[model samples]
Target chain A: MRAFLSSMVTPRALALSALALSFFFMMTLGGPFYYLAAFVITSVFSLLDMVGGQDNSDNDGKPWYYANIQAYQIPFAMLWFGLIYAWYLGTGMSDLFGVGGFLKTHTGFDMFAIRARTTAPELITGGYCLATIWAGFGTTIGHELTHRTWSKVAIITGRWMLALTSDASFSIEHVYGHHLTLGTPADPATARRGESVYHFIPRSTFGQIISAWHIETGRLARKGQSIWSLHNRMFTGWAMTLAYAGVFYMAAGWKGVIIFFAISWFGKCYLEAINYIEHYGIVRVAGTQVEPRHSWNCNQRVSSWLLFNLPRHSHHHAMGDKPYWELNCYPDAPMMPHGYLTMIYIALIPPLFRKIMHPRVLDWDRRYAVPAEYPLIVEANRRSNTADFINNVAPAE
Target chain B: MFSKIFGSATKPATVTILPADISFIVEPKKTVLLSALDQNIKYPHYCRVGSCGTCKSKLISGQVRELTDKSYTLSNEDIQAGYILACQSVPKTDLVLEVPKLRVE
Candidate 1:
């Protein structure tokens, strides 16, 4: 009974509850103010950084409930999408083809009345809530599922979730390109030393799409398929994005399309903000094996619990196939001074972020970087235009 | 250890490295690259996903179940030559493979 009960409340399982809470919060509140309430829920988790502290526990044995944990999120995510858009459309059950009038006749709960109550400020707050929840929940699950190369269902579902954020190509570039090139100059996702989050966000965002395009085109060329064909994942991803926008357009007309783009654009930026945090100012030689030291590891309990142990990034990069539940803690890896949400909040302020992170970067260079990487580290520092690489180096003729 | 000595019902497939003749047992449903890594075999690998072709090897004999499409990373010529990504390949039967390079590290 103890084992069974423990499995019911594991961190991974508990993480799914946030999605449920957000879904219910929006559904019950029935207007734009629900988004404000949802946003407050997300903010409360940010305080977990200080309150929850660190979790260094190991997930050595797999429980029976493990297989269904990730798969279950798909339904919640899909339903959340339907529910939020229904509220925005003010049609409720009407969008469900014939069921709309049938339900409206039976329940007499008019969604048209609720839509009248939604103010512009409330809608703007809804956009913020949509972006944050989608960024935090949708992308985290998407990242996990896309890595399940063994399951085609997982890949498709994960890609669709990412498509909502205008980053379906993450499945390709992240797995095929960024994972292989991480912490090197070739990795666009890696935030270079002295580069602010504002600078990193756009560069990483565009760089990833361009990188995914090259990978997809090269793959298609090898298979003797045209770039325009259905086999082209890049085009297919864009099609999925369009299909989602079409759904919005049909429901709420031009206002819906505008809101959809707003949600997607901000969600993409939030996703890039995560990328900015993971490997900021870290460097590794191009050919060397990716070790635990390459990423900024955060084991803060609340972040780990909410993000599905994504905060344990050192283990994720070291073993790409390992599930989030099984990601081990590496105490020696470079530590993030704050939890994931705190870092994202801090990263938004460029000057403050630099002041906090530059010292840590220098410490990493001194303690972790090997002799072979000195030249690269020195060159990176020079290019960053912040501090000089103060460590002594044996000059070669 | 007991499972190895007694031999489990779902028998693990044995992979014999070509020329070098180093043999290792891959547990059922485990990928070749990961099983080899578990035994501390220096099977040259960078990205364990089917993304990098670093773990590409010639399948001299035996069948394997590929987790992802090898054509994404492996060249057409390499695919035609029965080259598989060890990182993505799970051994189905006892196997022999020609690994191009084994890292000394």
Candidate 2:
């Protein structure tokens, strides 16, 4: 029975369930409660993580199952965008192909009435939900598929998913820029010690775009093509984002445009927040090999199930080609004190996050930092106004 | 259809590293750098994701399935000279590579 239950509650099942629940709640719940889908899902998963404990079992699941699950997100994400556009269209602009009227006639469901009654506070909550869904579904799957460099289908789908958050450049910068320069000062995604999530968001947001632009231009230059051409991925990606904004504009006018940008910006900020925590305070000497210890790992059961095992990040960095299901739990890597979602909540409050994480960083310095890395760690601490624990230490000769 | 649904079975491909006089069989679907590392042959590598270009080697002979675009890291001259990232290249046939960074005892 235990074995059967374990097989039934697989990661693929959990991911599919998340999509189904999100669809059901947002579709069925009218007015204010429509916005609570993401919040409820995150809350349930976070609670489960805290109670269910860690799962370090080897993930020997079939690759096709996980791949299909990720592919399913493409249609669901498109439907999510379509639903939001319709909601924004409202009673004032659109009858949504008279589906609203049909429902009103047949089911007495008053869709237009619900839209009319939705308050500003309700819309704010709706925006937050949109951000969460975008971050959770779009970014994670996008990150996975973009790494599949060998497949054209994967790359196109992945870029479109990231384009939902106005982050298509991530497909270029993350694989080429951040992966190469991670854990060093050169990496824009790597948060310096004592850097707040607030500060890291803007710095990383702009830094990634600029880095991606340079990378695309350089690639084009190698191919003897102009950056001004449509072949420039940054240009094409930005065009896709603008097209999305155009759809939102058609849906709800200026207000719809504002809401669209709001969701996109919030989604980008959430990605940066994840980045801020993933490698917070970890340092490595430039040109040194990126090892498992460079990334912080989490093995919390619920978070692992919901996140498609992104918590096994250290192994991902060590071997990028391995599918998400194949990512191994590197037990010796530096670990996060809480699940990924729980850590994101803690990281929001800068002082509290530092208070919890600073000691761990110091411990990493003592145990994980090689002799060559001692000076780099010291300098990082000094520059970031970190505690004076490693201040007096000199580089080992 | 089975291969499409589930990945194809592993078939070992021979890899010969020149200058260091190293030879290894790259397991099916495994990148050359990883296969070398698996066999305890220290083929120098930093980021295995074709980013840092630390694992760039001259493909002396044989076909390879390049996983990621190498233009981001390798120079035009290097590409013209047949350099490929071992970390991103899976041997499609028996491969002979000139790895300048291969650590020799």
Candidate 3:
């Protein structure tokens, strides 16, 4: 049974598995309670990440790359990803023919029914459910697809997924900006050694936005086009985001529009939080090459599987064009103690996150970093009070 | 690190690659994929540990030292076809090879 299940757990399926959650959230619409249920299930997912590190089938299965498995899945997943936006069109409109009626038969969503006139708290909670599902799952799938060098269709679909998050310029900043500058002082995306998740959010998010704008403008100017022209990729992304919002407005009315905005804002924040943990405290010198040492990796079984091996991030940076299934676990890369879901939770609590991550970052410096980088790493760690925290946690003679 | 511990200390070998039609010298005991990349020639590779098969190539001539056990990566049929992972095959002597055409984004 496990083997059969494992066989079905291909990367493409894993990528949009959370699309099912939004479906559920749609069904549960019209009530604060159902929305609460959607949000609470996220905690269950986090718990699974904590306990589910064992993979019985990894030892026995055919190598995941056999017979061009990923080739079929990527297209399938991208299509479904588009369908998700369509699904939102239905749920967002909330009152489509037989839609609310169909969902109402199974769920208690009343005032906040996908189409019902809802209260503020219900709107907030329901939006939160949608936000968590799309941000966590949709953004993940989009990220995986966007990294591909092939398949323009797949790449555009992935960018649209980020458009759903109201942060479509992610493709611009991430591909051109983050890949080039990750772990360096010049990088807006890489969190500094002492930076907390809360602080990192606005800095990375807005800074990347500014950086992406500049990048797109530079490209347009190089091609002799005005920055305000449609030739600017950043403008295209933002325009798509607005169009997506217009569809959401049509789906559920003004309430639908507001809820979509709420979802987008929350989802954008969640995506940034993820970025915060991906390369926290790792430093690189300006204009130097990016080695596998820059990004932190997690090979936790369940999270990596569900997230399509995203935890094996070192190889992703090393070869950004490498497909998700092709990503390898670099033994020499820095590792995160917990999977992404767990670290995400811990990151919210600054002291706790530091206590757990700072020492590990230090270990990365000592073990993996070149000696010339030692002073910078040490100074950064000291500023974060990592040494004092270590002394308190475990003092030595 | 793998080069320091397991790489040969012998003289480097000159390698010619097909498709790209580029020739580069591989440092003693270093893999052909790394050598091509070191010379600023875009070479197709990922997971340089002989895993992903992205660097699979046909070893047309000469000899190379296989750095990884490819029992899992390369099938018997593949081996018979002269297919070797460029990332794992370090040149033992001057060699000619063909790399699969790959588009790097």
Report per-candidate DockQ.
0.65, 0.61, 0.04
Model 3: per-residue Cα lDDT over B1-105, one tens digit each: 654565444787888877667778998867788778878877876545454466788989998778654533555667778888887787767898887583333
* Colliding pairs, model 3: A30-A112, A30-A113, A92-A251, A92-A252, A93-A251, A93-A252, A94-A114, A94-A115
CAPRI accuracy category, model 1: medium
Writing each residue's lDDT as its tens digit, candidate 1 over A283-333 gives 888878889999999999878876778899999998888877788989899
B-chain TM-scores per prediction? 0.87, 0.88, 0.82
Q: Show model 2 residue runs off by greater than 4 Å.
A: A1-19, A27-30, A38-42, A60-63, A78-82, A93-110, A388-397, B1-13, B26-30, B103-105
Ranking by TM-score: 1, 2, 3
Off by over 4 Å in 3: A1-40, A54-122, A378-397, B1-105
lDDT of 1 at B76: 83
Q: What is the clash count of model 2?
A: 0
- i-RMSD per candidate, Å: 1.0, 1.5, 15.2
Ordered by lDDT, highest first, the candidates read 1, 2, 3
Best by DockQ: 1
The digit string of per-residue lDDT tens for model 2 on A178-198 reads 887888888899998878899
lDDT, each prediction: 0.79, 0.79, 0.68
Candidate 3 per-residue C-alpha lDDT over A333-352 given as tens digits, one digit per residue, 9 for 90 to 100: 78888888888889999989
TM-score of each: 0.91, 0.88, 0.68
- Residue pairs with colliding backbones in model 2 are none
TM-score of 3: 0.68
By TM-score, is 2 or 3 better? 2
